[model samples]
Target: MRTGVNLAALATIALAFPSASSAQEWGFPGLGNAEFAAITAGGPAPRRDLTGAWDPGQAGIAGGDNYFNARTVPPLTPLGKEMLSRNRPTHGPYTAKVFEGNDPLTTQGDPSGFPRILNYEFRPMRIVQTPKAVLMLYSFNQSWRIIWTDGRALPQDPDPRWFGYSVGRWEDDTTFVVETVGLTERTWLDSGGFPHSEALRVQERYRRASENVIELTVTITDPLVYAKPWISRDRLPLKKLPEETDFLEQIYAASEVTGFKQNIADKARTQ
Candidate 1:
């Protein structure tokens, strides 16, 4: 009877303190084995250093200006053109006239998604690198995007998301290529109200130009919206911000404050 009790206690102890390999297989408390593997895999060989706060510089069609004025708008299908005609943007490439147009940003909605998020929103973003993922945190709305670098395939049936699902792979020693899909169609493609269907696929190539600069080339493909795939004319150049700078300011503060004032004015008028 004592031998049986001793054997049971040993079994319990063994289960409680699993081997390292078994622990890895079982994964961390809240994460799964696959996630653990991804997180532990580290980045590609000769990992390119892309850690920094990047500023979206200048204002033009290409540099986060109004999407409509950014060069010539991409050739749109008939449906796409109709959608563009229906959109009224309060902010233009050069100015903002909030009272004259329908600006989604003023509506306190999720305005930054995909290519639009990359556009000039007058906010800085920080890039944080980890073994399993590259995290892009935007100052606007305190938004974040995760670019998974694990050797896992994109989901076969991913749920629609505001920013879409993203998977990234290294192209060379200095460039990282990312592909995204499964985006919701409710958001505009740009501040100028460019439209896209759920079938939109965005491919982004990020090249570390130097220690202080990164260049991004974006390609948009959507058969439902455009007659052909279009590449952005401007190869966006992001300048690294100083390490001491803090990007904690709220970019959407004006919109929220104006909205509250408008509510008060409306109430007074009704009374």
Candidate 2:
């Protein structure tokens, strides 16, 4: 069993069960800030290659807003504010009561979806570069997404999807960029319950800083929601892991949550 609670665990109501090989470790064995720095200091990065197992360490886990360290969340429009006011999230500074939360992923076991997948519970993931697409396999919820890289244009008037449609390109020798659209508005922007419109567009920039490190930045732009675009993740460093590294299975099933609530969480409401 885990010793302490973290924001991601609380927000998702999920537990990570490590592989038998990693039973001795406390949490997923991610590098610390100093350790990541030391390990990533080597030679130049390769060109047009992002295939590796990556761990963001403690820096990827956000207690509140994931954008710009919560220092600069752009002001929301009137409609955006109204929509956000209706959401009852269980984590962050403005969290509601546990029973009052309406988070889709936590309470109903809906797919985390799009930016939410990257913003909250951001765990160790594996990136596989294929000839046609770049596939991202996330340890959290055991989910995966594909970003097409075969020079196709974004779909027009496409049906919205949970993960959305993404296309990627090499911006430079060291930088790879991905653009995503057609996301359903059901998912919150973060654990904070920030709302977005159907017009929401997300851009992800991945820069290979070294042989063992990649810096990622995400930008959110929704004209109907915020007055201006803002950065969600700012230069979050992902340290490379060995090829054979195994990730914990962290699935949050609806039936499991129902049982836990009835047995454990509901007991708290009476107290």
Candidate 3:
């Protein structure tokens, strides 16, 4: 499969907060502000100073059940209402890759045929700092990114990206403002199987609420899709993994490759 990303948006995200306050604090549970010889051993370049391992207290709520799948509260608008009524796909300019059974151009489709969810939480989304950008390293899918703050603006003409594009600016000494746009209509927003359209805008605020606690407040807006903009807040605990490291991945169903794909093609012909 091809990966579509907006380099300019990612560039903006990668360029922020090179030297964040060295205040001996982290933002998650299962891990904490602990000393790691590896970090200090090398002047903190590969420091494991990020949030980790958490239990949201609810079954299936951990990385296993809810990745951004937290219950959202977005007030719906009229346009959003109409879109939900039919679940119609977006019809416009697209250069998306086509799968035999999936909506080739539309952003929504999974081989599972059922909605997908993250069977677990990534827990440690360690923030790795570089001079130009802040990289949020995820233990899930080894999926990570460069949050750019290079004084460059988002590109006026950007290709559609699965993750869209993201840029960040400091809101205050303790908070970061992130704005993401130009995303593909295909991604599921949460592990609980929430979906979004291409015209989505995601605004996220990273706030260090306490010495060991950080809060992520997300506001998602998509007029051509959902009935309202949605918001969710997540609290994470800082963590430490001194003895080891970890990661995860997902594999789509194989039966859909032959069975479901043919089914869709057959229906199209009779219609």
Which of the numbered candidates is closest to the native, going by highest lDDT?
Answer: 2
TM-score comparison, 1 vs 3, better candidate:
1
C-alpha lDDT of residue 111 in model 2: 82
Q: Judge candidate 1 at residue 29 and give its lDDT.
A: 18
Decide which is better by lDDT, 1 or 3.
Answer: 1
TM-score result, candidate 3: 0.53
lDDT: the better of candidates 1 and 2:
2
Pairs clashing within candidate 2: none
Candidate 1 on 181-257: residue-level lDDT in tens?
A: 98887777666667788888999888877555567877888888888888753466664543334554554555674
The CA-based lDDT of model 3 is what? Answer: 0.42
C-alpha lDDT score of every prediction, in listed order: 0.62, 0.77, 0.42
By descending lDDT, how would the candidates be arranged? 2, 1, 3
Q: In model 3, what lDDT does residue 93 have?
A: 21
- The true-structure Cα RMSD of candidate 3 reads 13.3
Tens-place lDDT digits, model 2, residues 39-65: 433456888888877878776767734
Strongest candidate by TM-score: 2
Residue lDDT tens for model 3, 1-271: 2111123322322243211122233432222122211112111112222233222122222343234322443544565444333332222121112232234212233322111111233334456556566676654334566667666676565676755567777677667677777766555454333456667777777664432334566677777656667664444223233212332233333454345446654455432
